[model samples]
Target: MKKVLFCLLALGFLGGCSTKEEPKDVTYDWAPPFEEVRWSMGEDAVFETLDLDEEDATLNVNPEKQRVFSFASAMETEVGMVAPDFIFEPGFGLVGVNLHYIPMEKEAAETLAKLEAAYGKSDDGTWSGTKFGELNLSDEQVAAFKKEADIDKDEPVVTIALNQDAQAVKYQECVFEGKNAAILEQVLAK
Candidate 1:
């Protein structure tokens, strides 16, 4: 009877001393605020928030065409996910932020596979799953497109790109007719 009481008391004490915690307040919202949204905000805003410096980066700009600012090497910056070799364009009114993953490499195939599964496939093998989504490429187009984009050589590979844009923000990589774009050009020119 004493042994039984001791065991019961010990169990009760252990239970009382238990440190089972309610989950920590760990949470992540894939969707940030509209203004805080990557690429949906101004270029300076993005660079500021991400703690990136344009001057320290390798700048590739065409005053009359496109402006691409990339890090000398892969670095962690927040957006859809942490990606390597970040590329930023002023984009018109706050658009055109691209995260280049598996740059000039072949590991992006796994990432693309996951995307394909989530988004599903098109008859041509490019994802026709959603509107305003990444342009799907047919198998043939994949290789040729990479060559055209200078993503890879000798073989067709996936260079996973994440684009953040809002409906209100106009695409400006080619048009180059917006005030914001003009300002970017001026900055890039210097």
Candidate 2:
């Protein structure tokens, strides 16, 4: 009787340990906003400028004639404000654009994969992902992440992080369409 009782107790404890609950799926409906402009050169030609604030740069393309122009600058004051870079390809009608700002290379790659899974393919080849949440972080996690990442307090970190990340990702997606589509890939990734 003692042996049977001990075995049952052990089995109960093991079963309880194995029954960890899965994480809940989180959803967000907010999106980031970007600016677009139109430019004209010397002649009768008119060009459109996709001013992506995420990367602090602009892409000028003449879709009718199939011409491309790029301009880039470094970010100075604000966190998301960085100069942009442009690459020109004559034949391809704005194939893609991508901007990444994650400190770790591995994190950046993981972010990209999450984005690809969510949106199919980034329109402009740009994407961003940040991790911030209500869950209390260990001292080590906070210290390690803070050394290179911009972790804000007061506001929900996950929301802010996702917004920043969305800007870059949407910029790439909007490269061809000239319209920004903000999607939170991080929540899904987690």
Give the alpha carbon lDDT tens digit for every residue of 58-153 in model 1.
666656444556554444433212232333344433323344444322433443454445444423323211111132333444343333234322
Best by lDDT: 1
- Give the per-residue Cα lDDT of candidate 1 at 65: 49
Q: Encode model 2's per-residue lDDT on 77-151: one tens digit a residue.
A: 122333233323332222222232444446445545554564345554443323245434445444544554354
List TM-score per model, in order: 0.36, 0.22
Local accuracy by lDDT, each model: 0.37, 0.35
Whole-model lDDT, model 2: 0.35
TM-score of candidate 2 on Cα atoms, chains taken together: 0.22
